[model samples]
Target chain A: MTLAASPHHILTVTVENKPGVLSRVAGLFSRRAFNIVSLAVSPTDDERFSRMTIVVDAESAPLEQVVKQLNKLIPVIKITEVPPAEGVERELMLVIVKAAAETRGQVTELTAIFEAKIVDVGYDAMTIMVVGEPEKLDAFSDLVKPFGIVELQRTGRIALPKLARESTRLRSVKTARA
Target chain B: MKLTGAQALIKSLEMEQVEVMFGLPGGAILPVYDPLIDSSIRHILVRHEQGAGHMASGYAHATGRPGVAMVTSGPAATNIVTPLCDAYMDSIPVVVITGQVAYSVIGTDAFQEADTVGITMPVTKHNWLISDAQDIPRVVREAFHVATTGRPGPVLIDLPKDVANAPMEWYWPEKVDMPGYKPNVKGHPRQIKDAAKLINEARRPVIYAGGGIMLANASNELRALAELTGLPAVTTLMGRGALPDEHPLCLGMPGMHGNFTAVTAMQKADLLITLGARFDDRVTGKVSTFAPDAKVIHVDIDPAELGKVRLADVPIVGDLRTVIDEMIKALKSERSKQDPPDLAPWLATIHDWQERYPLKYRQEEGGPLKPQFVIESLRDNTPDDCILVSGVGQHQMWASQLWKFKLPNTWVNSGGLGTMGYAVPAAVGAKVGRPDRMVWAIDGDGCFQMTAQELVTAASERIPVKIAILNNAYLGMVRQWQELFYEERYSEVYLSPDLPDYVKWAEAMGCVGMRVDTADDVVATIEKANEIDDRPVVIDFRTDWREKVYPMVAAGSSNDDIILGPEFGEGGR
Candidate 1:
């Protein structure tokens, strides 16, 4: 019997902050033909390293195999998969749309309703920034599309666990005096 | 002391104790080469950049040390891509240095420029592009460290011409500060205990070992564990000499061209304990049905390999030798005479498969020789420790199947990349690395033509490597595939039988050349080639083109679908 397709998985990978490390990771995904649904890369607290939160569809490729291949990369220090139930996820999107005098009021109302901010105002356009789950951004984009969107950019989904804990385990030495 | 970037690079290599390097020089790398005269390291100039890369891999395989290769920018770097991929696939430790155009003109497409880092990113374990000469020593240390540790593979370091010319202070780093690269060397205690428990209980157990054993130098531990447990061991092509071929417990190779006993034994086994082996697609014919009834225990230095293909019931991530040593100790602590698994029935079944489908070939009386006959004769004539290298093709499979590998690091081939033209250059490297031992390159006509020019380097340098060309007048492996899968519609697989004439070609390269057409002449030709140790030699053996490797499992098919050759006709004749 065929196993049920696994759900979307978020992998948090820590790697050395070197020039080609990003290309090495991205190249591995493309070469292996593993689809990355969303990706967010940023520096970690330690300047020497960076962390990438990669969202992948397990149905498209085996998650275990992806993890293994990622581990093979020399710069990759650690990788952990966060199930949807254990994590909170969010994405940020910036959209520049037509805001001619005729529809400026209506656009402002829509922005207010979505809790988006008017980051920039040009003669004929306004840039709105929104931060939320991927689905929320998709819905916002669809609603704004009718208003003649000029440009849009999205930071792929980034996530963290709901429970506070150490990011990685450190060896602990127990004392017998106590 | 202040030094130019090229001098700093040379000093860095010296710091790592690099004894020899294989390379070809050109405009971009000329600055680096100028410093070679003063360095203690020996440079063996190759005829081609690809030859230099494969030679480095061959040196690595023979010596169990990180081999080094250097080449110039653009085409020179592109030429070595095949060898880099080959080393990546087989986990051979090699560090390749490439010259680059000046850093200022990198993106502007200057003369003889290539995006070395981007082009080699996927094929290399790691790579670096030098921004300044001061980074040379630290980067060189890290390059060798990354190349030789964990699951060993090739690493690249690209040096810009401007950086090589720039002056800077050189200092060796006391330690490599790579926080992201720590390898797990010790298996988890609990996992070791579980593996030992499985070994203690498996009724029909099989030990499937791969190149990891050779890469880790764990042959002794593997042999000890196999004998102590009375488990049958089957090697993958890369894992050929993990155990001596004559060992009673050894079942030879297991895969498409693997022996019948080894292939069937794996399919019939109840427990498969894989050591330092990834379940490659070649080894596991059809993943769904392979070892369908067996529970797996996969141990490897790379954590991802354990469950990448087949799920491991007792997955242990650690160094192969250390894990095996731990396993033996755990088994010993829990040993009971009554607890050892009874393997007699399983051994008897394996014996039956061996008897029914022994690796076989027939020779027509007083006619052209078969490739198998040539390989068998070569095996009979060579010393036990003679290092054998093969290029990829029907000849590669035949060499893997027919040769008796009694020692580790003695069988070198392009296993992962399945590259053609690997034999001649690699044999040269092997001979250069082990000057006291004999090196023979068993290659096919199609594969031999790819990198045969490297024989000139071997001859000129006095490497004394021997070559045996199994001349079948075509790309035999592809022809076999077309015959079996494409209904015998042979396309452009043939290379003219008399083209360039191998004997004359070898002689022109300043080496002794001989041709053997009949089965009777094979041994004499080999003996004559073996006798000439002052220079390299090439022997062209005109073998029958019609013969195909037998006991074949067509790619992507289940092991159960193994096709026997005509020799095992209807009613198993």
Candidate 2:
């Protein structure tokens, strides 16, 4: 399933802190059309290198291009293209919706299906907290859309895709080989 | 004698330049959040804890960096499952740091207690539960190493509440000691020789480059290989721009949305060298009939990728760049020969296919806009080095179909994990990375609404990202399926009622926005959007609501089944 320019993908890169290293790496990402959702460069295990994670919602081809470009940067040690299904992913969302007496109960029920917790509640509206995958969150958000969702805030996506079982075994094998 | 767990985690992540995180605060993790207050790391507070995971995933994907998300124990930790599963299957590198109900309450089902490690075991690249304060530094360090190396996937470190808050003497490791994490960079010398032999012996050879080429940072190697072997190269979507488009030896994208010439060439090739690319369905059409007569040489970093679908004649395991270098050194250029003896007949057949089924679209008789027109407009307006992000569905297919993508990473879309609502925020991410290049979010109406809220992030960040919404008023891809296979029973596929007024919504989000109801307005609106200030821009192009994407091959069908637009004779009969 090819995702067109969708907001589902995210890229995170960590690199070395050196003069023009940021420019060199950033040059590669921008050169390849890889977008940076949230870019932060700071400290790492080694004061010499920094880690940067960006979110670009592209298909594998272009994202790979960006990664290759990043790898070319002398400061960039490694780059990865983290796909949604290959890892554990999450996004943060903040929704403010109407909470009239008539709609409050149904809203609560809807939020329950989405497993949204209420962070802040007001007579006129409520700020709900629901964190799940995008689909469930989306369904819940849509459910409340009819009830008048006034505002929404979603953090970009974060993810962790599990290793294949074979690699797990390989980890053992490498130790044996070593 | 003590450092905050958050500080330790920050210090650990700081070792990785931990700049951004997406998460929500809860009882068990309050202490961890407390230290975040003193740190410079910016945390985007999401409405739901799950969004934190996706936000991190999105951040990672857009920037080619690992994304991190933090959440409290039990349900908050569990809430991140869907994206975890999504990331697990799609191979996104995300680090999910979940706060547990303290080391003491781990198994008691205490308030907010859940086995996050057990729950995320199958979804993360690796999962570590640290109950000891002293382990946070090492665990976080290991997480970054595992998450972004080799085939790059997600990794997690679930910290207990007591552990996150526990005082630790911070000790940063000089190098991440990942005993289980060794990725192969150099290919086997013998295998490289065999690959050269395959290249030398092949009469009609085609090189298929995958995402691994990008992963190995081997585009130049790939190009060199293609040139050294005189083989025309076909790139998987993930391998897009493995070779510049203008290169004579380059065959454009190959897969479901690929060019007729590309698909036809792959079908007729006698020798197919597949590098870093998996035999994804979109690229193979139907497994049984795809390149039936070709001898496949598969090269990839991961050994499991060698024969998962289309078995390789020669399987080489190593980083693509190193392998290509080895092959270049070993392979003899003098041995390069012209395509097979009967190449003329095959080339003629492909040329015929190109003439028969050219990719095309007609504005619904009297309709105002065409989807292709919008994509082409952006392709023209965007700087040569600009990035174009796409949403899933017909628009993504259309962009792949119409966009003249000469370079890799310039086009961002979800491929293996066909996630919608990916383009907008991804474009925002891209703009954040490279503020100089123009970024466009090409999405269908059905997908735009999915992650539309991220527009606020783009607006707030002052990232000059532009969104081009192909307002087709339906989940165009599924609707096309319903139209073709289900006798046009549109079902719930129609999105007219649910679609938002994108122009107004963009304005509400504080973006410079407009709508394009006709072909003539496309260029102007895109041009106007480009001129906007340090804010995002939106253009909702009101295209014909119901139209079909052409050149579709039915599921489980062969390459012979491609339905070329009426113009093409046959997609290579």
Candidate 3:
């Protein structure tokens, strides 16, 4: 996690990306004294709703206040709080590791323990894939640094509801209504 | 019939007179690529997506037309963000198009999809995510009009994959009606009259111009007002070519790295007529002391700019052309009210200051390659109509100093945000815009290295933009600061690491590359770089790393407090 890690919380937002939308959202969080740890945003399939998944790094009171301010923005549609334990939180990471033939087996051994797959094996290097909660990925990555980590690229954090099934039903109902 | 969102985007782009677009293709936008085969718009394949945006910005800056860029979602779109921010900050008109995943899986963690709009909110002037086919044409038109008008900036329209395939009748509208997009075009008559009154009444007056002159294409009008009112002029860094540098009344640029005469003139002025300029911090030294005694008449197109910093006695919100024209008429009406004009005292003061603080470099006469001479030589050799582009920091300031730019839109740079990698692609875009004239990109070693990869685009496009790299291996600006403030601790400024040899680097990127290790070789190498005949050339001058630019006024210090004559310039004091 980055230095400014927010506690586990979920927020869904819609924004019209004119100048200062990020400033407005970040301002709202900072004004309410909330720190956002994890964030993900993507244009909805139709390209209208730019969905945002934000994890506030503050206690319950300030995080809720931040959410309320986010809701005030014209582009922000809804921000729902999600329980960290109940929500499905996942982050995907691709690690390019520097390993020699002598150290290949050790790297492979560590990869197996994390349930990671060896995506590619070059002459002097290998790439491993890890997909899980950010904490788990962080732990797995930390274990392999001794083996010489070449580079790391993260796809940030993307999430779905633990009750994702219920959200589908709600989406279907909304689609039917539309 | 059904059409994908990407197809609708392509169709919308075609309707907006966008004939060329620059970008790197990615998976999320393949749907649009599939449909692009049938369209007339030509996409110049760039090695990187960021180059696409800067190229478009260059095109816009050069031609006084809107430039277009396309990229897929996620990192591809993220790459465009830097250039979009560059365009937004510098006020270059560019439209960026990105592809998005289907609406069905927006928050479900779709592949190769990221909310580009959300990431770009703070960077762009305006952006839209078009989910509905019905809104595509209207929004696309709106984006083009908005990006190109008023204070020009980069606008984005993210189209989903499915929407590009969804079929609809394609119709192009003559104009768009955006309720939220009305730009002020006519100046307030009273404000114009007041501005004219001030100019006519003042003993000492100066016209401060900016990039807004290019946005409004108000160069001719600016010249008219300056000539008619006989007000000696000074330009913001971005407004280098707004008026010819050779004009006797032109005081050159003001602020840090600004001429001593110009800064002195600005300090002595009683009335400051700022047209198409926002008294930026770089131009205005300490906000409190910046034109402290002067009554400011600010004329700008953007309403938000008014009183955002310094208060305006006459705040005229309108088009630059219309406002300048109106001011001219009003000044003529109040001709009899003209004050007894003799700036002999002011000019004498400026002359004394220039003599006291001459912009003379103190480096060894026969030392390693110096950027000042390279920039001066480039200005002399480059055609009268040739466009000049520059990266951020000291090199950019040097280019502004040495180059005698004659027209607006000929000097393209990122002044406000000071983005380092802006010059190369902007020069490439400038070449595309004006295929006939020569284009030169002056950049520091650090800034050139940031976007040097764009050499591939110039090679691929047969757009030869001469790149003169002021190579002082170290991050000159940062190193200068460490020397000044950090007790010369020499933190992370040194790059002893074996980096790419620029000579071979340019050849690898399919362009001509040369190096000048000595001052004697600079003139010849630059001449050779210019003679490449439709192929981009890079001349890396292995300049001295431990030097600093002179005539420095600390970031927030008063204009009169500038320190001159090299040995760390303003930093030494």
Docking quality band of candidate 2, CAPRI definitions: incorrect
Worst 10 residues of 3 chain B by lDDT: B564-573
Specify the highest-lDDT model's number.
1
Clashes of 1: 0
Tell me, by DockQ, which candidate is best: 1
User: What is the number of residue pairs that collide in model 2?
Assistant: 139
- What lDDT is obtained when candidate 3 is compared to the true structure? 0.79
**lDDT of model 2 at position B521:** 74
Clashes of each: 0, 139, 26
lDDT of 1 by residue, B1-573 (tens): 999999999999999999999999988888999999999999999999999999999999999998999999999999999999999999999999999999989999999999999999989988999998889999999999999999999999999999999998978999989877888899999999998988888888999999999999999999999988788999889999999999999999999899888998899888898998888888889999898988899999988788878998999999999999999999887676447767898899888888888998899889668999999999999999999999999999999999999999999999878999999999998988999899999999998889999999998888899999999999999999999899999999989777969999999999998999998888888999889999999999998999999879989999988887789997233
What's the iRMSD of model 2? Answer: 13.7
Per-model TM values vs. the true structure: 0.95, 0.72, 0.76
**Share of real contacts kept by model 3?**
0.00
lDDT of each: 0.91, 0.74, 0.79
Residue range with the least summed lDDT across 10 consecutive positions in model 1 chain A: A169-178
Q: What is candidate 3's CAPRI-style docking category based on DockQ?
A: incorrect
Cα shift from native, residue B118, model 2 (Å): 3.1
